[model samples]
Each structure stands twice: as C-alpha cells, then as structure tokens.
Target chain A: MSVSVQREDFDVGLEYARFVAGRTDVGGVALFVGQVRAESGQVAAMTLEHYPGMTERQIDAIAAEARARWALDACRVIHRYGRLVPGDRIVLVMTAASHRQAALESCHFLIDWLKTKAPFWKYEESETGARWVEAKETDDQAAQRWRR
Target chain B: MKILYFAWLKTKTGLGEEDVPQLPAGVTNVGQLIDWLAGRGGGFAEAFANRGLVRAAVNQDYAQPDTPIRAGDEIAFFPPVTGGVG
Candidate 1:
C-alpha cells in the first residue's frame, strides 16, 4: 500500500511502472486518473485545499479498506493539492491483483471512497466570482453503495 | 486546545488557527464545542450557523458531533470534502 498527498503533479506512466516493477504475481492492473474539469466551461482555475496530516492519513485508511475488500497485491493513491487549471491531473488510483476483477473493483472502490471520505476541498474561479465547491449528493450516493 | 479552520470556514472566520489554553467546562464534546464557538458571534456564528454544512475532525481524524474532546486535543472545522475523482 502506498499513499501520497503532494502539491506537485505526478507522472502516471512512471508511477505505474514503479508499481509493477518486478511484480510477477500481479496479472492485472487497474488505474484511474482524475483531472480538473471546467464543468460549465466557465471555470478558469481551481484551488485545492487540504488538512495536512489528515489528508494523507484518511487516504491511507481508504486504500487499506480497499485492500481488505479485494485481493490486491498492491495499491497506490496520489492526490495533488494547490492551484490547478482544467485538464490538470488531480488524483490517481492504481490497483494490482492476480485477476482483473479484483484490480478493477478495488480501483473503483478507492475512487468512490476518496470522493466523499477524504478531507480535501475545492474552490473554483469563474467569470462571476470564486466560490467553494459544494459536496455533491451524487457523490454521497456513490459512496453509500460501498457500505455493507 | 488548538482550533483550526479550513477552506471557506477559514475565510469566513477570518482565522486559520488559534490556540485556546483551555476549553470551557461545557465543551466536552464536538457538538458542545461548536455551540460555544457559535456563541462567540461575529464570523464564527455565521460560519457555524448551518450545522448541516460543517464537518469536524478531532486530532486529524474525522469526528462526529458526539466525539469526546479535551484541552490538548486539536480540533478542526470545515466544509465537507470535495476531493477529485480517482
């Protein structure tokens, strides 16, 4: 399990290579990358804020939970904080397993859980003004599906 | 106790963090602490007016309204998380 919260961007290919390096047991790898989007084409930039210690710890816990639920050989979560524009990478989730189902399911679980459970916030700058992004009810519902 | 605010709450409260040597006797739990903070009036009141919007963490961990708190604890208040996709 690996989890990182940084202000700097990451290279997805490099990260994936490092995750799978010399891991012969892993047969399947599932990866997801989240990027900043101009939902209405009005967003100029976005500022991501997070609680320092809490952000990393929460993500680690989420990754651990995903591991517990699936037969994952390895899991990686990298989330970026600070200012970013549309198309900038914001987060990444990668999971490796002996089978595709485990890898894919774990990757999905990590992303869904991180959306609602992590301690990060976003502020968007647009034409009208800057405003804090509100938590979407759809995200809550997305996370709720994982609860057993 | 150290009280911290983040995101919009920090903007609304006009403060990022504060050191409170001690918490009042009634501020035993997260909920009571929020009530006391709201009583402070001014920006605090406005930031805490809507309980539905506020989220709390005790010592960097997500906390519920009834979570126990103490003088040495580090408490944080902020809006719900809006993290990016996977």
Candidate 2:
C-alpha cells in the first residue's frame, strides 16, 4: 500500500502502474477520486486544513485495515493538503485485487473509513463568513457498515 | 501543550493555534477542558459555550466529551468536520 499527502498534483496513470508494479493476476482495479464540489450547500469554495504528522498516519492505518480485511494486491491513497478551490481534486483511492468484488469492496471501505477516521477539517468561505461544518450523523452511520 | 482550532472556531477564538499550559487537575476529560476554557471569557466562552456545536480531538483522533486527555497531548477544538471522503 502507498499513501501520500502532498501539494503537487498526481497522475492517475503513473499511480496505477506503480500500484500493480509486478502483479500479473490483477483482474480488477477500483479507483475513486474526490473533487471539491462547487455546489455543496450553496458554498463558493472550501479550504481544507489538516494536522501534518497525524493526517498521514491516520490515512495509512485505514488503508492497512482495508488490505487486511480483503484480498487486495495493492492499495493506494492520496490526499492533497493546503488551500483548495472548488472543482480541484482533493483525494484519490485505488485498489487492485484478483476479483472485482474485493477491489470494489476495498475502495468503499477506504472512502468510508477516511471520512470518519482521518484528521481533516474543512471550512467553507461564503457570504456568511466561515463556518466549521458539522460532521453529519449519517457519516458515522455510513462507516459503521464496514465494522464486521 | 498546544491548542488548535479550525474553521469558525478558529475565527471565534481569534486564533488558529496557541501554546497553552499543561493540563490542569480535574481537566482530564473533554467536558472539564471546556469548563476550564470557558473561564477565559469572551470569545473562548462563545466558541465553546455551546456543547452540541463543539467537537474535540485529542492527539489528532476524534474524541468524545468524556474522552480522557493527558498532559502534552495536542488538544484541538473545532466545530466538527466538513471535509471530503476517500
């Protein structure tokens, strides 16, 4: 598994190759890219803030857990830090497995776990100034689905 | 110890981060920490005055109001989270 938190943009093609470096039995690869939505609750732009050391560790741990739970051949998670505008890419998750089910399941697990587990905070700057958005109870409940 | 704030909480605190004294006695939990911080008066009280609107994390992990905190732990107070998934 590979995890990175950087300001520079990432290439999905390059990242995908690195993920399946020497694997020939990889029959499926599931990918997820999260972009800063321009229309979330009528917000203009969103700024993402995170703790340096803590954020990376939390993401890596979640990825590891997903790998352990499924028969994944490779897993990759990347999240960008610093200020970001609407429509900008925020994060990406890719998982590879011999079967489609494992790959897809791992991808779902990665996203759900990151939502509730990672140490990231976002504040939307709008006409009403900035407000620290609340973590919805729905997110917690969504993550609970993988707690087998 | 360092106290960090995020989003609107940071604006209300008029600070994004601050160096604070070590944890005081009887302030080992999130509720106690808020009560102690409320004594700072003004903005501190306003930012954390509403228990339901506030959320906390100890050492970078989501912690409940009853979560025990230790000295030197990085305590962060914010108005919950609103970031992207995956």
Candidate 3:
C-alpha cells in the first residue's frame, strides 16, 4: 500500500510496473488517472492546496479502508498539488488484485472516497480572476453511495 | 492549541497557522471555537461568515461540529473539499 501527496508528476507506466513487480499473486491491475479539464474554456490555470499533514493521513486511511473491503494485492494513490493547467494530471489511483472485480472495485472506491474525504481544495484562474472552487453537491452524492 | 487555516481561509485571515496559548472560555468544541473565532471580528468574521462553508479538522482528522476540543490540540479550518477523480 502506498499513498503520496506531492507536487511532482508521475509516470503511469513506471508506477504500474513497480506496483506489480515481483507480485506473482496479482492477476489484475486497474488504474485511473484524473486530469485538469478546461471546464469553462476561460480557465488558464488551477492551483491545488491541501492541509499537508491531514492530506496524507486521510488518503492513507482511505486506502486502508479499501484494502479491508477488497482482497487487494497492492494499492497506490498519488495526488499532485500546486499550479496545473488544463490537460495536466491531477491524481492517480491504481489497485492490483487476484481478480478483476476486486481490482476494479477497489480502484473506484479509492477515487470516490478521496473526492469528499480528502482535505485538498482547488482554486481556478480564469479570465475574470482567481477564485476558490465551490464544492459540488454531486460529489457529496457520489460519496454517499459508499455508505452501505 | 494551534489553529491552522488553508486555501482561501488562510488568505482571508492572513495567517496560515497560529499558536493559541489558550482557548477562550466556553470554546470546548469545534462549533464553539468557530463561534468564538467569529467574535474576534475582522478577517475571522469574514472567513467564517458562512458556517456551512467552513470545514474543520481535529488533529489532522476530519472533525464534526460537536467534536470536542482542548488545549494542545491542533485544529484546522478550510473550505469544503473539491477534489474528485480529477
């Protein structure tokens, strides 16, 4: 299990290779990458800020929950903070398991829970000015599905 | 106790973190601390003007409104999380 919150970008291929390397029990690998979108077309940049200590702790806890819920061989979560432009990668979630179902489901669970439970905030720079992004009710609803 | 702010809250308060030797009387929980912070006026009032918008954490963990607080505790306040798959 690994969780990293850093400003540096990561290579998907390298991470995936490292995750499954020497793990003969792994049969499936599920990976998800999130990138900054040009939502309004006017967004020039997006800055991500987080509570340093809390961000890592929360993400690690979430990963632990995923491991408990699924028989995952390995799980990796990488979230980048600092200024990013549209098309830049923002986050990555990868899970390896003995079966496809466990790998896929755990990957999904990690992303969903991280959405609302994590302490990161986003600020967007647009033509008008830079402003804090508002939390969407949709995100809350998405996270609610995991309660069961 | 240490109070920390993030994102816009930090910008508004002009402080990222501060050490409070003592919490005011009657401020024994996250909610009450917020109310007490508002009482400090100025940037604090503006930052916490909308209670629903502020989110709190106790010792780097997500904290509820009624979460108990005490001396030597590290408390953080910020806006709701906007992080998702992206």
Candidate 4:
C-alpha cells in the first residue's frame, strides 16, 4: 500500500521488519531486493534519472495495480535514484498476504512492472566512459506475460 | 506546448525542454510532431532517425503515434524504460 522513490539507500532487514510488524492477518510475505552489480568490475557506478513527476505516479500506479489484482493485505515498493555503487540496494518489493500464492505472485508482478513501467533510466559509468543502459528484449517479454 | 526530452533523446537534442506555442503545419498528432522535428535536421533529425527506438507520452500519460496533439499540452519523448534493478 506504499511506494517510495528516493535518492538514498535502504536497509533490507529494517524494511522487512517494518513491513510486517504487528500484522496478524498476514500469513506470508514475499520479498525481492535488487542491488547494483559489479559486472566484472567494468562498472564503477550507476546514475539513475527519472521524470520527476512521472516516476512516482507510475510507481504508485504499479503498486496499486498489484494490490487490486492480488489478494494482498499490504505491499511496499521502494526505488532509489541518484548515483549508486555495487552492493547498494536499488529497489525493493514486498507483498504480504494470508497465503503464499498471492504473496509470491504479487511480489514477482511488482518487480517486473517496476522495471518496465517506471520511468527511470540508468547511466552506467565504466572504465571507458559513461553510457545509458540499453533496454533488454527479455525484460519486455517478462512483463508481457503478465498481461495474459 | 512544452516538449520535454529524456535520456539519450535529451542528449541528442542538446536540450531538456523546448517551448513551442504552436504546432507546425500538418503536425496534428504525436507521429506528425516527431516527423516534423526529425525533419528539422541536425540534432533533432538524428535523435528521431530510428522511429522504433523512440517512445512518448502526452500530458504525462503514455501516448501512441496517433494520439491527438493540441496547444497547451505537454509532450515528452524518450527511449524505452531501462529495465534493471529499478
């Protein structure tokens, strides 16, 4: 039921604990955390830029859609912008439901949609220079299956 | 109308935003607008050379090629969403 877009890092353990704290109706919680990758030491850092107004709107809508489609008691989505290095957390999606099925599916759905739907673009700084990360066909295909 | 660019499009245009009070002749939709800009030559032309690589939104909502355009609205052009951690 909450979506946060920030330039700061987040703690996975802290977030997970806060998300399900005192929630008696929740039987299971599914979590997905995305962190910056080293990519064989080729990438030094990543800068994420987003449409200031549209990024939050799109993320909130994505979270809402997941809640509407799945039987979930609560959900949390957090995405970080600005510059980040390897090992830094980039995103988190958690879903809590009375059963594991809804929790797992909704968590997966949120992660997929956040990647394709959110208006954030990544710029990778490497040894040679910096370049915008290319969109992947596989990512599109992953999101496409949710439509069916 | 306000036109905003993002990512590589922003870099190619050498601009983040441009204000055009009126659409050029025959520019009545998103597709036509892109064509008009692409025909401008130089940076604009290069940015839009590959039609399939460009994506857009009208008034902050996802827009299609045939989406109607009118004065006083905002339009943004960018590449596909970078699908990764975020």
Candidate 5:
C-alpha cells in the first residue's frame, strides 16, 4: 500500500512493477493515470490544490474500503499537489489482485471515488480570467453506479 | 487559527495563507468562520461574499459549511474540485 500526495511526477510502469514485486499470488493488475489537459476553447494552464491532512485520510479510507470490497494483493495511489501546467500527470492509481475481475473492479472503484470524494480543487487560468472548475455532476453519477 | 487557501480562492484572498485569531464563542463552525472572514473588508469580504459557492475542509478533510471547528485546527478554503491529473 503506497499513498503519496506530492508534486513530483511518477512512472506508472516502475510503480506497477514495484507493486507486483514478490507477489506470486497476484494474477492481475490495473492502472489509471490522470493528466492535466488544456481546457477546451481556453488558453489557460491548470493548477491543483488539496487539503493536506484530510486528503490523505480520505484517500486512505477509499483505498481501505476497496480492499474490504475485494480480495486485493496490493494497491497504490499517487496524487500530485501544488501548481501544475497542462500535460502534467496529476494522479495514478494501481491495484493488483488474484483475479482479473477484482483488479479491474477495484481500479474502477478507486478512480470513481477519488473523482467525487477527494478534497482537491482545480483552477484554470484563461484569457478572460481564472476560473475554478466545479466537480462534475457526471463524475458524481459515475461514482454512484459503484454503490448500486 | 490558521487558514489555508487553494486554487482560485488563493488568488482572490491575495494572501495564500494566514493565521487568524479564534472566532468568538458562538462562532464554532465553518459557516460562522466564513461570515467572520467575509466581514474583514476588501479581499476577504469579496472572496467569501458568495458563501454558497465556497468549499471548505477542516484539518484537511472535506467538510460542509456547518462543520464544527476547534482552535489550532487547519481550515482550508477553496472552491469545489475538478480532480487530480495523473
């Protein structure tokens, strides 16, 4: 279990390798990488902000819940903080399990929960002015599917 | 009390972070904190003018406006999140 909230970039391949290292029981692994995108029809860079202590706790809880929901071998969640520009990698989530279904489902569950539940905020610096991005309703609805 | 700012809220607040005096006895939660900050004039007032649009976290966890707070706790003020980029 690795959960880090940092500004440093991470290599998904290396992290995945480390996660599976010495884990003979693990039969499957899934990964998701989120990146800052240039806003559509806007000329602004992206910035991310998060609440320090609570962010770690909330994410850890999410991971723990996923572990309880599935039989997992290992899991890792890395999320970046501070100022970030377009194309920067912002978060990475990887999970491993004895079966493909568990690995895949857990991965989905992790990202879905993170999107709506994590306490991170985003701001886009645009030509008109800086805009704070709202948490998407679509993300909330997607997360709801997992609870059902 | 320490208050941290993030994203656009940081921009609007001018100061990214500040250490403020504890609110009076009855001002025990985020909503009261916002009302107090919004009364502080200029940028503080403008930043928190629209209380409904603001988001807050107490001691680093996402919290509602009515979340109770204690002294020495770190309260963060910002807008709703878009998400983390990988």
Candidate 6:
C-alpha cells in the first residue's frame, strides 16, 4: 500500500512504469487518473486544501482497505493539494493483482472511497466568484455501494 | 484545545485556527461545543448555523456530534470532502 498527498503533479507514465517494474507476480494492472474539470470555462482555477496530517492517513487507510478486500499485488494513491487549473491531474489510483477482477475492483473501490471519505476540499475561483465546491449526493451514493 | 477551520469555514470565520481555553462543565461532546461556539454570535453563529452543512473532526478523525472532545485535542470544522477526480 502506498499513499501520497502532495502539491506537486505526478507523471502517469512514470507511475505506470514503476508499478510494473520487476513485478513477476502481477498479471493485471488498473490505473485511474482524475483531472480538474474545466466546467465550461466557468471555473478558472481551484485551490485544493486538506488537513495536513489527516489527509495522508485517511487515503492510506482507504488503500489499506482495498488491499484487505482484494488479492492485490500493489495499490497506490496520489492526491494533490494547492491551486490547480482546469485539466490538471488531481489524483491517481493504481492497482495490480494476480487477476483482472481484483485489479479492476480494487482500483474502483479506492477511488470511490476517496471521493467521499478523504479530508480534502476544493475552493474554486470562478467567473461568479470564489466558493467551495459542495459535496455531491451522487458521489455519496457511489461510495455507499462499497460499504461493507 | 486548538480549533481549526478549513475551506469555507475559514472564510466564514475569518480565522484559520484559534487556541481555545478549557471548557466549562457540561460540555463534553462536539455538539455542545458547537452550541457554545455558536452562542458567541456574529460569525460563529453564521458559520455553524446549519448543523447539516457542517462537519467536524476530532483529533484528525471524522467525528459525530456525540464524539468526545477533551483538552489538548485538535478539532477541525469544515464541509464535506470534494477533492476526488471528476
């Protein structure tokens, strides 16, 4: 399990290469990258904020749960903080397992849980002015299905 | 205890954090603490006026209204998370 909450952006190619290097036991890999939405030019930029210590711990716990539920060879979560413009990468969830089922399901599970459970918040600087993005009910429903 | 605010809560309260003095009697949980803070009026009242919109964390862990709060604890108040992928 690996989790990182940082201000710097990550390269998807490098992350995928790192995931596959010297992993003879891994037969399947799943990777998901989340980018900031452009919102039809209404949103100019977004400032992502999170509890410094708690955000990392929470994402780690989510990754740990994915490992517990699936037969995963590896799992990694990378979420960003600070100001970012539209189309910037915001998060990455990667998982590899001996089977495709574990790889896909665990990857989905980590992202779903992170959507609602993580401590990070987004404040948008838009044409209308600045406001915090409200949590969506759809996101909650997405996470609800994964609950034990 | 150190009380912290984030996102809109920081903007609403106009403060990032504040060191709170020891609590008086009968205030043991987060709900009561919020009530006390709201009673201070002005921005505190406005920030916590709607209980449904606000969420709290005790010692960096997601907490409920009944969650216990003690001295030296680090409490934070903020809205629900909106930090995942699109």
Candidate with maximal DockQ: 6
Candidate 6 positional error at B77, Å = 0.5
Ten contiguous residues with the weakest lDDT in model 2 chain B: B77-86
For each candidate, what is the lDDT? Answer: 0.93, 0.82, 0.92, 0.90, 0.83, 0.90
Candidate 1, residues A1-148, lDDT tens digits: the string is: 9998999999999999999998999999999999998877999999999999999889988988998899999999999999999999999999999999999998988899999989999998999999999999999998999999
Please report, as a residue range, the 10-residue window in candidate 4 chain B with the lowest summed lDDT. B77-86
* Model 6 CAPRI rating: high
Q: Which of the two candidates, 4 or 5, achieves a greater TM-score against the reference?
A: 4
lDDT of 5 at A46: 66
Worst 10 residues of 1 chain B by lDDT: B77-86
TM-score, chain B, each candidate: 0.95, 0.88, 0.94, 0.95, 0.87, 0.94
State the DockQ, from 0 to 1, for candidate 5. 0.58
For lDDT, candidate 1 versus 5, the one ahead is 1
DockQ of 4: 0.62
Report the CA-based lDDT of candidate 2 relative to the real structure.
0.82
| Residue range A83-125, candidate 4, lDDT tens digits | 9899888998999999999999999998988889888889999
Indicate the residue-level lDDT of A19 in model 2: 83
Model 2: per-residue Cα lDDT at residue A14? 89
* Best candidate, TM-score: 1
Candidate 4 lands at a TM-score of: 0.95
Candidate with better DockQ, 3 vs 4: 3
Q: Which pairs of residues collide in model 2? A: none
Model 6 lDDT tens row, B1-86? 99999988888888999998797568899999899988888898999999999999998889999999998899999998896587
Model 2 regions lying over 4 Å from their true place: A40-43, A126-131
Residue-wise lDDT of candidate 3 within B1-86, one digit each (tens)? 99999988998888999999997898899999999988889999999999999999999998998999999999999999999355
Model 2 agreement with the true structure over A25-88: per-residue lDDT tens digits: 8999999999877664676777677767777878888998998899998889998876777778
* Each model's DockQ score: 0.80, 0.50, 0.78, 0.62, 0.58, 0.83
The regions of model 6 sitting more than 4 angstroms off are: none
